[model samples]
Structures are given as structure tokens and as C-alpha cells.
Target: MLIELKNVKKYYRTGKLNVKALDGVDLSVEGGEFLAIMGPSGSGKSTLLNIIGCLDKPTEGEYILNGKNVERLNDDELSEIRNNYIGFVFQTFHLLPEYDALFNVEIPLIYRGISARERKERAEAALEAVGLKERMKHKPLELSGGEQQRVAIARALVQEPLLILADEPTGALDSKTGNSIMELFCRLNEEKNLTIILVTHDEKMARYGKRVVHILDGRIESITLN
Candidate 1:
């Protein structure tokens, strides 16, 4: 399994009240699987994503990424795991408007202290993978919604991470542009064997994945394999 979660629980303490965002959830994601998580607001969908991505720790139970238990890792170790093993794509592009596409893609490599020449070369390769090689010098603001999202995808690819976690990746684009983005995801999954976990409210968007998981009231309602 690429990911394994056993009876995971995430609780939030707000003053005198305790809210359970995730209530004893158990899940697993196999390597090279394209999975989509769907849910209504407050369903703990995002919380689950955060936990799986190693961005947040579970309040209880075990979170094992690949063969290692994340609950045993310290903050610095977890950060290292996130940088070296996982890639994230957000709804809002999240690209720095001031930086060119190449520079933006180099940010993750910079954190890892990769040499400047290697970073540029790898970033260019990633952009080429996304068919944005010619747009490497353009800033985020200069690209269209679809192009900007492609740049974000390239940035994620630059790390060559084990998994990609995308939170509503197409929410900011129009229908046509969103379809293009989702299609790109499908192509990447087939061509690169990239393990992808995406969160979206759109059923059409969810269909792009091989399996769809539905969440409700902080619990998994169903899992449908397409």
C-alpha cells in the first residue's frame, strides 16, 4: 500500500468544547491508484486529505506512508517526508505571481538544497511534461487559468514525489478549462503511473479517477470503483 490509515481520529479543541473532525476513519490507498474524495461541507474531507498528505498528524491511530509510520516522526522529519515524498496541488494555483513558471517550479527543489543548474533543468523537464515548456518564462498572472494550473501541476511534478494530493484543483477554472485540467491529470496517471488523490465536489471531476470515495458527517459513506 502507498498509504495506510488505521482508525484515525482528529479532534479539535476550541475552548471548552472538543470537536471531532475525523471520527475513527480507516483507509488505504494502493500505489499508482487515482482516487477522488467527495463530500459536503464539514464532512472532514479536507481534514482527511491533510492527514494523508502528512501535513497534519492524526489525533489517534496510525498513519503509515509506504512502510514508515508517520506518527513516530518528529516535525522536522515529517517536513522532510512531505518535501521528498508528497506533492500538493491546491484549488487556487498558489503560484507566486512575481516569479516566472520556471522559478515557481524551482521552489520545492530550493527547499531540498538542489544545485541551481539541476533545479532549472528538472523544472524545465517538468514543464515539458505538462506541455508548458514554451511558457517557462511567463509569470502566473500572464497565463490563463488552465495554463496556470498546468504550471502548478509541473511544480508538483518537479519533486517526482510518490503521491500527488490535490484539493479542488479545478475549482478556479471555467468548465472547459476545468475539463482540460482533469484530462491532463488522467493522461499523467496513465503515462507516469502517478498515484493521485484529489478532493472535489463535482461528480464529473471525480469520474476522472479510478476510484471515488464519498464522505459524510466525518465518516466514509461509500467507495465506488470505476
Candidate 2:
């Protein structure tokens, strides 16, 4: 399995109250699988995604990613794993306003200590893969919503990660643009064997996945294979 969560739990302390974000959630994602998670706000979907992406730790239970127990890894180890193995696409795009498209895509490679030449080359290739080769010099403000999202995808791609974790990837785009982005993801999954775990509140968006997992009140309500 690419991801495995066993009886996982997460809790948040707000003032004197303790809120359980995840309650004994058991989930798994296989290689090359395109999975979608859907739930309303406060349903623990975001918490689950955070744990899977190594951005947050679980309060209880085990999280084994690619057969390694994540709980055993230290913060630095976890950071390394996240940088090398997981690619994240956020709803906000998260691009730096001061940087152009190519520079934004090259951000992750800098942390990897890649040579300047290699960084530019890889960033160029990633932009080409996302069909944004011509926009390399354009800043985020100059791009459309769809184009900005594509730059985000290119940034994620520059890492050549084993898994793509997208949280409401199309939230900022119109329906037409969102559908096109979904098509791009579908193509990537088929052509590159990318494992995608996407989280969204839209049922229509969730339908794009081969499998769907629904959460309610910090627990999984159903798992549907399409």
C-alpha cells in the first residue's frame, strides 16, 4: 500500500474543551490509485489529509506510509519523506507573488540541493508537462485562475513525488476550467501511474476518482469503488 492508516486518531484542545478530529480512522491507498475524500466541514477530512501528507501527526494509532511507520520518524525525517515522496496542491495555489512561474516551480528543488542548471531544466520540463512552457516568465498575478493552478501543479511535479495530495484543487476555478484540470489529473494517473489522494467537499468532483471515501464526524461512513 502507498498509504495505510490504522486506528488513527487526532485531537485538538480549544480552551477547556477537547475536540476529536479523527476517531479511529483506518484507511489505505494503493499504488496508481486515484482516490477522493469527501465530507462536510469539521468532518475530519482535512485532518486525515494532513496526517497522510505528513504535515501533522496523529494523536493515537499507527500511520504506515509506503510500508514505513511514520510515527517512528523524527521531524527532520518526516520532512525529508514529505519533500521527496509526497507532492501537495492546495486550494490557494500557494505561489509566491514575487516569483515567476518557473521560479515558483523551482522552489522545491532548491531544498533538494539541485544544481542551478538542473533546477531550471527540471522546472522547465515540469512546466512543459503541464502545458505551461510559454508562461515561465509570467508572474502569478498575470495568469488566470486555471493557469495559476497549473503552475501549482508544476511546482508539485518538480519533486517527482510518489503520491499527489490535492486539497480542493479546483476550488478557485470555474466549472469548465475545473473539468479541464480534472482531465489533466486523469491523464497523469493513466500515463505516469501517479497515485492521487484528493480531498474535496463537492460530490461532483469526488466522482472523478476511481474510488471515493466519505467521512462523517471523524469516522469513515463509506468506501465506494467506481
Candidate 3:
């Protein structure tokens, strides 16, 4: 299994009241699987994605990622796991406005202390993979919404991560653009065998996944195969 969450629970104490974000959620994902998590606002789908991406720790239960127990890892270890094994794409295209597409995609490798030459090479390859090679020098402000999202996707792919966690990646795009972005994800999942777990509220988007997991009240309501 690429990811295994057993009886995972996440709680937040707001003043005195406790908020349960995830309640006894258990999920398993194999490598190369395209899974979509569907839920409305406040459904804990984002929180679940956060935990799986190593951005947050569960309040209770075990999270095994790539055969390693994530709950037992220290902060630095967790950071390493996130940097080396996981890539994240958000609804907002969080690209640096000042930088061009190439530089934006090179940001992750820069943190890893990769050499400039290698970073450029990998970033170029990733951009090409996402059909953004022609716009490598375009700044976020100069690109369209879909193009900016493509840049974000390229940034995520530049690291060649084992898993990609996308939180409503196409939320900001129009229907046509959104479908194109989803098509790109499908191509990556099929061609590169990259494991992807996407979170979206749209049924149309969820159907693109091989399996759909419905979450509600901080828990998985159902799992359906596409």
C-alpha cells in the first residue's frame, strides 16, 4: 500500500469546545491509483488531505505512508517525507508573481539544494510534461488561469514525488479549463504511474478518478468505483 490510515482522528480545541475534523477515518491507497475525495465545505476532506500530505498530524491513530509510520516521525523527518515523497497542489495557484514559470517550478529543488543546472533541466522537463514548455518564461500575471494552474502542476511534478495531493485543483477554472486540467492529471497518472489523491466537491470531477470517496461530518460516507 502507498498510504494507510487506520482509525485516524483529528480534533481541534477552540477555546473549550472540541472540534472533530476527522472521526475514525480509515483509508488505504495503492501505488498508481487515482482517488478522488468528494465533500462539501467543512467536511474535513482538506484536513484529511493535510494529514496525508504530512502538513498536519492526526490527533489519534496511525498513518502509514509508503510503508513508514508517519505518526512516529519527528518534525524534520516529516519535513523530509513531505519534500521527498509528496507534492501538493491547491485550488489557488500559489505561484510567485515576480517569477516566471521555470523559476516557479524550480522552487522545490532549490530547497533541496539541488544544483542550478540540474534544477533548470528538471523544471524544463516538468513544464514540458504539462504542456507549458512554450510558456516557461511567462510570469503568472501574464498567463491565463488555466496556464497558472498548469504552472502549479509543473511545480508539483518537478519533484517527481511518489504521491500528489491536489485540493480542488480546478476550482478556480471554468468548466472547459477544468476538464482540460483534469485530463492532464489523468495523463500523468496513466503515463508516469504517479499516485494522485484529488479532493473536489464536483461530481463531474470525482467521476474522473478510478474510485471516489465521499466524506461527510469528518468521516468517509461511502466509496464508489468509477
Best by lDDT: 3
lDDT of 2 by residue, 1-226 (tens): 8889999999999999999999999998899999999999999988999999999999999999999999999999999999999999998999999999999999999999999999999999999989999999999999999999999999998999999999999988898999888888888888999999999998989989999999999999999987
lDDT of 2: 0.94
CA deviation > 4 Å runs, candidate 3? none
Better of 2 and 3 by lDDT: 3
Clashing pairs for predicted structure model 1, backbone only: none
Give the whole-model CA lDDT for all candidates, comma-separated.
0.93, 0.94, 0.97
* TM-score of each model, paired residue for residue: 0.97, 0.98, 0.99
lDDT of 3 by residue, 8-89 (tens): 9999999999999999999999999999999999999999999999999999999999999998999999999999999999
Estimate candidate 2's RMSD in Å: 0.8
- Predicted candidate 1 versus true structure: per-residue lDDT over 174-221, tens digit per residue: 989999989988888989999999999889899998999998877888
Ranking by lDDT: 3, 2, 1
lDDT minimum window of 10 residues, candidate 3: 64-73
Clashes of each: 0, 0, 0
Cα RMSDs of all predictions? 0.9, 0.8, 0.6
Stretch of 10 with least lDDT, candidate 1 = 212-221
The superposed Cα distance between candidate 3 and the true structure at residue 20, in angstroms, equals 0.9
C-alpha displacement of 125 in model 2, angstroms?
1.0
